[model samples]
Target: SVDLWKEAAMLVPEYFENTIDIWEECDVHWSPDLEFDQAADPAGAYADLSSDMTKSNSYRSWRKQLRDFIYRDVTLPLWQDETSDLYSTPEETESGFRMRVVQAIREQNDLEVEKLKAKFKSKFESQRDRVLRAEEKVKREEAQYKEKSYMSLVSIGSSILGALMGRKIASQTNVSKGATAIRSASRAAAEKADIQLAEDKLEQEQAKLKELEIEFDAEVEKLEQRIAPDSIKLEEYPIRPRKSDINVADVALLWMPFAIHANGAKEALFTINE
Candidate 1:
């Protein structure tokens, strides 16, 4: 097969550097004995392989040979619109390859959680501080109230003392007027006391009258007792004898006639019978 790569390079030497690199990477992947690079794309690897491009003179010559062979024998059959495995390897990340990506995602979530925790911590501290400040303010207000209440009580006490002192000074300064008022007050008090005393005297007089009335009644009762009749016993009266009307002469004379007739008749009858 004719190597059109060399002819194409001769015609367009400006693209030789890139085309030569593509050839080098493909020769390394698919060795001389193998007919096809069915599994590897050296063109794709040329863009990303880790190699010192400056020291690849011998590698470049061998790559040119493989490139010439591939362009004439294989690539000429494929169109410009068609994709080839030799030019492109699919970019795929297996589950085994995803370890780094998962690590990055987990790190991001951890960072977000840490930030949220920090934000919440800050908010909590702010709220706690507000509560503490409010408590302090309440304590301050309570202290002020207690102080005010104490001051008010002291002022009231002072006012009362001042009033009492003023009254005493006025009373002492105007002796004549105060004396008259005092006498009037004393008179009123005395009247109340006199009323109480009079009530006591009246109660004592009533008690004496009650005692005299009780004594008079007792004396009257004694007089009545003396005039009342005494009770007599029934045994003190003699029992009356019962009188019968039958006389002793009536009984004896009546029985004496019968006695005389009975004796005479019996003696005559007996003398006849004998």
Candidate 2:
């Protein structure tokens, strides 16, 4: 028998249900810097995480294409039709469909054309109401599919989804002295995983920037080794934006929920000012 967790793409709620556990997991009660991914995994605990990361990224890219088709192509025309009430009755819809067919008939007439027209008439007579109901059903399914697919991505990343941009948020003003830390093995693992994820994201970006700088340096070095010194020196490459440009406030606003899921809503903070 397959475990249900296998069916689920991600299992975040299991990790971040308790508020106290998260702080202890990352050892954040002592130091926030300790929550980095390097500190999270004790040995080689996160080894199994790559399969999930690849699935989540690929699914996101695939769903984006599907969303375009459903929203841009199928759903909109039916939605417009519904809003306009353009085909309120089977007769009206059938008549409109007939007019288009007849217009086609006028352009190219033949016995085969008459037979096609008769077939359509017979279909309308037999299933006009059914056709109208099916049209409505198809539109509903398309709308539902689009909504579900967009949400599926969050669940797919079961590790880091705390909440989303459009959803409602809890007020931090109602704080309790109850937000104390916990000390447990499982909780520690969850907090560590959260820290690891953030660190991984940061390092991935840092590595990309570092690679580009190296490539640019290599080219510049080759030019100096070959060309005359009188050659117009290439302008110094502009530095990439420092991680300091990142708005800690903005990041905290976004990352709290992810930490909530990753570390059990443990009062996680991305930045603090004196």
Candidate 3:
């Protein structure tokens, strides 16, 4: 599409060059940027200029030549109607279409990004709650593990003392006390293993929560980049002033000269009152 537009745009300058040649040959002169001459008589000067332009011999010669050229060489083959426009006028065309296109694309991307952000936000929030709960559970388990470990150490010390006292007494009652201490030591060791298992499980859950949070943040950043406004071209087309309502000065200075010199050369079949 861009290549096609470039090719078309290239033809515009070629057409303008041909028109310029005709304009120069006819001694047609004007400028879109021509400022009002402050030193010249503003009132009568315009009238004199208008009369001189319409009465020029060069203007007459070009008008006849160009009419002949268009009817014979250009318009004859197409056989178009007199009312049909040969070329588009600048005023009739729309500007800023490219900017509008860019805006539309940006808007679509923004909407998609918002949707993704909402989805990720919801997921992140849910996972955050889970992480918080897991952290709290881990804290409780750690405290419980500390208490069980301490009890296990005390049980082992008691078993050692009972065994020593039984050996010294050489009696049945001291032996019974030693056996009870051994049973207590075994239960404490089992509780210690359970506590260790709980701590390991807590560590695994915490690691998973950390990983999930990192993943969520990374995805959110990706979505943000996808919707960044800098991704689209924002250059705008230049705007021209509207000329729908023609004033008297415009007719005398700009419109009349242009129509007489350019459009008049074509020997238009119909008059352009508007």
Which candidate leads in TM-score?
3
Q: How much is 3 displaced in model 3, in angstroms?
A: 24
Better of 1 and 3 by TM-score: 3
Give a tens-digit lDDT track for model 3, residues 167-209: 7654676666666657766765766676676667667766776
Top candidate (lDDT): 3
User: What would the per-residue lDDT of candidate 1 be over residues 1-274, giving only the tens digit for each residue?
Assistant: 2222211211111123445444333212211232223444333322233333344564556445544544433322211111111111112223322333344444555565566556556555655565555555555555555555555555555544654667763554445444544555555555555555555555555555566556645644543443222311111111221223111111000000111254564211111110
The alpha-carbon deviation from the true structure for residue 168 of candidate 3, after best TM-score superposition, in angstroms, is 5.1
Residues 1-274 of candidate 2 have per-residue lDDT tens digits of 1111101011122223223222122211211222333254233223233243344554454344333332332211111122112222222343353344344433433444455556555544445454454555555555555555444443434312222332323323111111211213334445445555555555555555566556645644543442232332222222222332322211110122223346555544344221
As for lDDT, the candidate ahead, 2 or 3, is 3
At residue 58, what lDDT does model 2 achieve? 43
lDDT of 2 at 51: 40
For candidate 2, which ten residues in a row score worst on lDDT? 2-11
Ranking by lDDT: 3, 1, 2
Model 1, CA-based lDDT: 0.38
RMSD of every prediction: 76.4, 49.8, 13.8
